[model samples]
Target chain A: MNAISSFTASLPGACAQGLIWGIMALGVFLTFRVLNTSDLTVDGSIATGGAACIMLIRSGVPAWTAALAAACCGMLAGLVTGLLHTRCRIPAILSGILTQLALYSVNLRIMGSKANQPVSVDKYSLMLSQRYVRAAGLSNPIPLLVMIISALIGLAYYFFGTEIGCAVRATGNNRVMARAQGIDTDRATILGLIVANGLVAFSGALLSQYQGFADVNMGRGAIVIGLAAVIIGEVVFGKLLALNFALRMSSVVFGAIVYYIVLQLVLALGLNTNDLKLISAVIVAAFLTLPNMKGGDRDA
Target chain B: MLEMIDVCKTFNPGTVNEKVALDRLSLRLEEGDFVTVIGGNGAGKSTCLNAVAGSFAVDSGKILLGGVDITHMPAHVRAKYLGRVFQDPMMGTAPDMWIEENLALAARRGKKRGLKWSISERERAEYRELLAPLGLGLENRLQTKVGLLSGGQRQALTLVMATLKKPQLLLLDEHTAALDPKTAAVVLELSDRVVQEHSLTTMMVTHNMRDALAHGNRLIMMDEGRVKLDVRGEEKKKLTVRDLLEVFEI
Candidate 1:
């Protein structure tokens, strides 16, 4: 009974964390599902965002400006990866790995060569904080997270409906057709990477504010978590949300929430915290295999 | 409207696998000429069309389109004046996109694509009118994904897209090669109608001798990366598959 109560108490905190990570998953979805490229840069870009945001806040920058600046820094990282892939002729996965590996040193520099840094909500005004997780009215983080997610989804929907966005989609769907139709596919790919990493860093910025600290390893295994959210969203809400792009994105956030809730339940059941990464891997692997199993059934 | 002057291209130069794909190939087209190209494998029929489409830069010589030199233009930049249909049915259209969306993309081929909505109400109506005449029942299924369409249907749609904006030059690189015989015939007929309607300067490459003889006003047979036979007017009208076979010794 004590364990059950504790698990229930952790649900709100888990939901808030899931929502924060959902933004990162949306970034992953842009590359993994939309652009048909698996980008591993999120692992480092997320930490870069956290480190940049915390450092900027410590320097007396406003929290919102710091977050935006962090996102811009993330975009620069994506630009390097894009140039490496398109100009230098590096393979897509390899380019992402290279950028991620390089960002480790860059992230350490951003945090003043320290492994971790903390930002106190009492010392600096944060956009959102864990102290407000269960607070009533406007101070509660859930409503603000929901509002921010809705705005992001709205912006994304509008962007994708535009002509330039259609070109990006075409570039993703068929490069030959896109080029034949006069779209510079290389430019489109670079633009997509820039936008995807910006969102990832923004998520990391909010996460650091919520947790009150930025660590060099904060973003380790981030790509796996993001992929887990994406796969879980597709397998669970694919049928219901497949037709509408906005709904599909919303499903991804819900998938993240479900993942955290499950994690909270497991932890409440006496699971070791260090085994969390193993559990995440298992979950993602299971979900990834589900579609292939269905395909096999059809083949047989 | 189109000219390739002494264009040459070689693959794997300085290597044991060196192969000369285009050897000083020279060709010219009048403003409204419908030229059919036929050749054996490695005879550079498709290579010639690709050269005109700016798929690769030639080692020497210039490509002039509408009296403007475009030898150094990249493929996507040169696409402003060219409409291309590839041999593979899957190569010309985005399978995951809707039919109407594909048409919208084609409509803005040579134009700048800004933040404007991808498909307008006016353009949607125009696309419906354009697709209705195909008799493929595609007009009513504008929202259907292109991947769900058959090979013939996709080829037909690609033909429509290629002609939608009335390009300065239309390139049909064995556009009907992958379809069944009946579908091939249907696509051929559609291609002819669209070409005649627009009076588009076209270069169609085909392996079928009968198709080569039946369709275009001009016929050119390629051999060893150069034009071996150029027939037109009464001479082309009088020529048969037997004459072509005898000339090429196929």
Candidate 2:
């Protein structure tokens, strides 16, 4: 009974973490599913966002402005990966790895060589934080995070419906067709990576603010987490969300919430917190294989 | 409307797999010309169309469309003046997109894409009207995904899309070679109708001899990366499969 109560008590915090990571997962969906490319740059850019946002806040910038700056910084990281893949002809996965390695140094420099930096919830105003997760009224973090995610989804839906957005979709679906129709596919790819990484960085900024600190290693294994949310959402809510683009985006976040809730449940069951990454990897691998295993009757 | 002067393209130069795909190939087409290309395997028939479409950089030579030099232009850049239908129907349209969305992409060819909605209300109506004539019942299924359509339907849709913007030149690279006999004939008939309706300067590559003779206002045979025979107008109409076979044997 005591364990059940404690698990219930921690549920709100887990929910908050899931919502933040849900935004990150949406970014992953854009690259992995929409653009048909697996970009590993998010692992590093996520930390970059947190670092940039926290540092800017420390220098007295407003929270929203700091978050935007962090997103732009993330976009720059994506641009590097895009150029390396499209212009230099480096393979997509390798290009992302190269940028991710370089960003490790860049992130450390952003934090002035510090391994971690903390922002006290008491010292300054924050958009959302753990302290507010359980608080009453407007101070509760759930409403704010929900609103942010909704707004982001709306923006993404609108952008992708536009002429340029269709072109990008075509580029992903059929590169030869896109070129035949006169779309500058290289530009479209760069734009997609930029948008995807920008969203990832924005999520990181919010994550740092929520957790009350920015750590150099905060973004480690972020891609895996984001992918987990995406695949989970698809496996669980895919039928319900497959009708429209907006629903699909919402399902990704829905997947994240489910993931965190389950994580909280397992942790409450006495699983060591340090083994969380291993658990996550196993879960993702299992889910990813489900589709292939079920449809193995036909050979390609 | 199109000219290729001293065009040369070599694959894997100086390597064990080296092959000359286009060797000093030259051809010219008047505006509104509908030319059919026939050749044996590796005769550079498809390579000629690919070169004219700017698929890759030619080793040396000039390609001009409507008297404007396009030799150095990239494929996508040069697409502003060309419409293409590939052998694989899947290569010419995005399968995941809606039929109307695929048409919208083609409609914006040679134009800058911006923040406007991909398919406007007006454009949707226009697409419906354009698709009505294909007799494939596709006009009613504007919201359907292109991937769900059969190979023949996709090719028909692609033919409509290629002429949607009235391209300066239309290149069909064995556009019907992959289909069954009935579907191939349907697509070919549609192709001829579209070319005539728009008077599009067209180049169609085919391995089937009768199709090469039956369609197009002109016919040309290629051998070993060079033009072996060029016949047009009255001469093309009178030539038979036996004559082409004789030339092939020689």
lDDT of each: 0.91, 0.92
At residue A148, what lDDT does model 2 achieve?
93
User: Which portions of model 1 miss their true places by more than 4 Å?
Assistant: A296-300
Worst 10 residues of 2 chain A by lDDT: A236-245
- Candidate 2 regions with alpha-carbon error over 4 angstroms: none
**TM-score of predicted chain A against the true chain A, for each candidate:** 0.97, 0.97
Model 1 vs. true fold: TM:
0.97
Q: Summarize candidate 2's per-residue lDDT along A91-165 as a digit string, tens digits.
A: 999999999999999999999999898987799788888988898889898999999999999999999899999
Tens-place lDDT digits, model 1, residues A144-233: 889999999899888888899989889999999999999888888898898899999999999999999999999999999899898889
lDDT of 2: 0.92
Total colliding residue pairs, candidate 1:
0
First chain of candidate 2, TM-score? 0.97
